[model samples]
Structures are given as C-alpha cells and as structure tokens.
Target: MNATATAAPKAKANATAPARGRPVLGRFPLPLRVLGYALVVGVGLVYLLPFALQLVTGFKTDPDAAAHPLGLVPTTPTTAAYQRLFGLSQAGDGVPFLRWLGNSTLVAVLVTAGRVLFDSMAGYALARLRFRGRSLLFGFVVGVMAVPGVALLIPKFLVLNSFGLFDTYTGMILPLMVDAAGIFIMKQFFESIPREVEEAARVDGAGVIRTFWSVVLPMARPALITLTILSFQGSWNEFTHFLVATQSGQYETLTTGLARFVSGGLGGGTQYPLKLAAALLATLPVAALFFCFQRYFVQGANSGAVKE
Candidate 1:
C-alpha cells in the first residue's frame, strides 16, 4: 500500500506520453504549417487593426479625423492635441490633465499595496491556521467574488457615506483594496506549497507571521508577482468604483477624467487625437508590466490544473 501510494504519481506522469511514438507537433506537414501560419497572421491582423486605427487617428486634426475615420494615414499629423493636454497650446476652459494623472498613480499604488498585503494575510490564515469559522469565512469570500461589481455601486456609496470616507482618496481606493478574487488566488497558491517548508521554519523557532513573511512568502514569488500585476491593472483601469466613490472633479483619476474629457462635453466636436494620447499614456505602464512579467502570467494560466 505504501509503495503503491508513492508510485501512483510517477505512474501517471509516465502514462501521459507514449514510450515509442513520433512527436505530435512533428506530424504537422508542410501544407499544414502554411495553413497554420495564414490562420495565425489573420488573427494577429484582426487584433492589431483597431490599435492601428487608434494610433493613426490620434495624429489627425479634428476636421481630418471626422472626414476620414477609416484612413490609415492622418491628413495632418499635428502635435496640437498633446501640446494642449500639456498646457502649452492654450486650455479652452482649463482641463487639469496633470492632476488627473497624479490622482490615478496615487490610487493605483495604494490599492495594489493594500490588496497584496491584506489578501495574503487573509489567505495565509485560511490555508494554514487553525481557527473557528474558517470554512464559513471562506464561503463568504467565495460568495463575495460571485457578486457582480456593478451591483455594489449603490451599496458601496452608502457604506462609504456612512463611514464619512466619501469623495476622499480613502473612499476612492479603500473599497477596491480588499478584492475577493485576490484573496482566493493567494489561498490556492499557499495551499499548493509543500508542508515541510513551513514545518522546518517553525521547528527553527519561527512564529506563524515570521514563517509567512520570511520563509513562505519568498517561496511564493511567482504567485505574489502574478497577484501584483493583476491588482495593479484592475485598479488602474477601474471606472465604475471611482464613479460611485467620488462626486467631485478634483478626485478624478485617469479613467474617470478621460471618460468625461472624451465623451462630447469638453469643447469642440471629436478631439480623437487628444483622447487617444491620454489613453495611450494611461495604458503604457500596465502594458509594460504585462509584457515584463509574462512568465508569471503564464504560470497563473496553468495553475488551476496543478495538484500538490
């Protein structure tokens, strides 16, 4: 029985591949590769086309943009939109673009930090500690994750107002900090780890928090990095929460600020170039991060199938 239990995993791993067969990918013939390449390129073009349109339209003058929405080349590639955004080309009624950028950065950083710290703490307790109502708390978290965020707008507003945090930076950020999905991610990751690691740390006179912070968390770099990227992207692009959390223009972050700026209210007709430039600026940091930590993201993709 003991031998069978030990050999079971090895048997399955060996069973997954045939001992004497050609590689599945090698069986792809020349024509198949040509067809596959064609298919892949077609999909790639489909995705890139919209972005290409956005970039080209951003450089066009307002009149040219209205005339040629589908044109690949701008009729007049002017930097006037960018200059105006930077306060160099005269503000029509004064758009505080810099203030919006700062607000977004501050909120995203705080929200990311809060989710990482608080989510991990809750996850650790759920995964490893002995406590009353653990299952109930975990069930509640799962239920919370199931609740659609749109449904919470009114409720979140009421709670924030009750707590006197409405329209403050705290109001803009705090509600988004403790995400149920982030807590769930950390819990699954902690539970996947080998038990012996924590046992050895504890045997060497480390407490739970010490073991977690020093020993366990270091081993959880992949999961932590994945969580960090997700949290940052989610909170940064977030629109609805900010809409409900704050009422004043002073509290406007990039998503909220840009939405108002572009949605036919802030002057002339369609300043597509200015709108797209501001969007590209807001998108760059998260795009850099997504590309940089791609391996961690890939690890997350397959994590659901991994068993301890």
Candidate 2:
C-alpha cells in the first residue's frame, strides 16, 4: 500500500515535468515571467497604437483630430469624413471618391488576373518545358528582378509614349501585369511539384497544356492563393507606377487620390479626419484578403521550406 502510494506521486511528477530543451514558463522565476509578459504587451501596444489612432481620428472632427493626435477618444466625434468619402454629404468637396475606388478595383483586378495567367505560364515553361535557351530566359528573369523599379520609370514612360498607351488603362496595367518576382515565385513552386505526377498525366495521353491546367494547377491551390493575395495587395497599394502612368485627373486611383487629398486638397485645412478616414478605407480590402487567405499563405511558406 505504501509502495503503491509512493509510485503514484512519482508518476505524477514525471507527467508534470517539462520536455527536454523546452522551458516551462511556470518554472521561470516569477519576476522574469512578469517582465517577459510586460515586454510582449508593450511591443504589441506600440505596434497597434498607430492603427488605433487612425481609427479614432477618423471619427473625430478635423480640429479635434489635429488637437488630440494621439488620443484614443475623440473629443467631438463626427462622420463628416466618411460622408464626404461616400458622397452622402459634402458634394461640393469634389473628391470623386467612388471613381477613385472603381479605378483602383478595376486596375488591381486586371493586373492580378494578368499576373496569374502570364506568370504561371512563364513559370511552368521555365520549370517543366525543355526549350532552347530555357536557362538563358530564366537567368534573364532573375536579372530583371534585381533591377530597381525606380530606375525603369523613364524607360517605361518612353515605351508607353511611343506605343500610344500613355495615360491609358492599358499603360497603367500592362506595365505591372508580368512581374519577375511573381514569375520566380511560380517557377519555384512549380519546380517543387513532383515530376512523377506530370509523367502520369502524360501516360494518360494528356498534353502539356491540359496536364498543367487540369492536374498541376489544381494541386497548386496554396501557392496560387499566396500569389493571388500578393498580386491583389501589390496592385491595390501601388502608387508610384500609377503616378507616372497617367496624368489625367480621370485616371486617379485611390492611392494617388488619397495622396492628393492628404496634401492640402479638400478645402486645405489639413483635413485630418478626411485623410484618416480615407486611409482606413483604403487599408480594409488588403487586410480582409490577408485575414481570409492567411492559412493558404502559411501552407505555401511551409511547403517552400521542404527540401528537394
């Protein structure tokens, strides 16, 4: 009876012990644990403070926002900023918010589509298809990725002007449609896929395009989702390219329009509330996309970590 009682305590101790190389927080000195938790909370708050301020300022009156820039609570809350953005009130503001939104949406969508199609095709050809100068072409793609985008502004403008695509939607989108980084991403992902799967499809009499579209593409959901989210976010948030691509006010996208709005436009009194509101709205779509597809992104990242 004594031995059995002693054995139970030993078993319980064993069960409660931390695994090797893994430190248990409970076992840490109490002061250290408290300090660690405080540090973590402090860091989190620091990162979140700006976003919190933005959200709060969006509801404040212009003067209130300017006065209490860091305050979490608005002294005088108002929706005038949102009203101006949505055109419900302040029609005389002349922001054309909806037009900017529509232009951004259209450009982002088309650019994302073009990237997915063209990048995937180029990636597949580089990864799987045996062709003349295949290595040379892939090397060129990698080299292109190294070139700073800012340096290409003059060349892009020259080409666009020469081709009569200047100030057009085609110029805005076509230049961004096929990104070398995207092609590299797709190529690396395609290379990671097992060749046996393609061979099996070939055995079943599927051609190259058929196998890629029907078999390989279906298995590439995680990578595709990652690429889609990136393409959407990049295209949506793009500012510099859009700035140079079109000069007409009619072609102004959200980024450019928001820049203009924040820079003394909308009655020229800083318009903190309006700027904050516009910034908040602009951030929503990318945030939503990331939250929705975060799992796919994680899966894609983990998949890339696997050794060949």
- Work out the TM-score per prediction: 0.89, 0.90
- lDDT of all the models against the reference? 0.86, 0.89
Clashing pairs in 1: none
**lDDT per residue, candidate 2, 1-308, as tens digits?**
99999999999878766554355666688999899889989999999999999998989998888788988999978888888888878556646889999999999999999998898888899999999999999999999989998998888888999999999999999989998988888888888899999999999999999999999988878878888999999999999898888999899999999888777665668788888888999999999999999999999766656636
Q: Which numbered prediction scores highest in TM-score against the true structure?
A: 2
Candidate 2 residue pairs that clash: none
lDDT by residue (182-230, candidate 1, tens digit) is: 8898899888888999999999999998999999888777888888999
| Regions of candidate 1 where Cα sits further than 4 Å from its true position | 1-26, 91-94, 303-305
lDDT against true structure, model 2: 0.89
